[model samples]
Target: MTILNETATRTDRWTPVCSYTDLLPERGAAVLVGTMQVAVFRTFDGALYALGNFDPFSGAYVLSRGIVGTRGGEPTVASPMHKQVFSLVTGVCVDDPAVAVPTYPIRVTDGTVEVSVV
Candidate 1:
């Protein structure tokens, strides 16, 4: 897992979290953006997503350890603690629409994965 440090370049509001190659397909990694704990995911098709690491259902900062998969074509991550699935695109709970986690805007510049925590 890569952490944001002095070496990472900041482009406007986006902060560099890790290199695109550092993330494995269908896996997640946790990184600290200021005081926020962000969970970064790379889908099997090479898509990238960023969500808040806190699991609302379990009250634990463990979303980074969730199982990555899909639901009706939507990329998702199932909370490891309670098995609550969340949409990687919108961060909405798949089982409970009213419940949701925060999603961050992410993009890759060159080969680095950057997320906007602003």
Candidate 2:
């Protein structure tokens, strides 16, 4: 698993997992991230977001289906397995600020969505 709050190691070509158009608002899908699973999403406004797919509390692969919304202008997704909301930008759980998920560097190039898994 990728460690958070530590020195970040850079990698070449963050494997293309999914596309921006693939996500459905209020829904989510899982993709592979260098052996790790990542969830990429598209908001109602067509904005792209990425986050780890597993839920820390339940340890279930269910963060993708979490509701996508904003809290104080920060994009966030609420876990479907539970109600733990996570900021799409920071991946920090809204309900509990201490816990967070591994967020990847996401960018759109030529209509493709890519993430930095390392």
Clashing pairs in 2: none
Model 2 bad stretches (over 4 Å): 1-11
> 42-102, model 1: which lDDT tens digit per residue?
9988888889999999899999999999999999999999999999988999999999998
How high is the lDDT of residue 15 in model 1? 81
Q: Please, what are the lDDT tens digits per residue for candidate 2 over residues 12-49?
A: 55566665566667566788877888888777666666
lDDT of model 1 at residue 35?
93
Which consecutive 10 residues in model 2 have the weakest lDDT in total? 1-10
What lDDT would each prediction earn against the true structure?
Answer: 0.88, 0.75
Model 2 lDDT on a 0 to 1 scale: 0.75
Candidate 2 positional error at 26, Å: 4.7
Task: Give the 10-residue window scoring lowest on summed lDDT in candidate 1.
Answer: 2-11
What's the count of clashing pairs in each model shown?
0, 0
Model 1: pairs clashing at backbone N, Cα or C within 3 Å: none
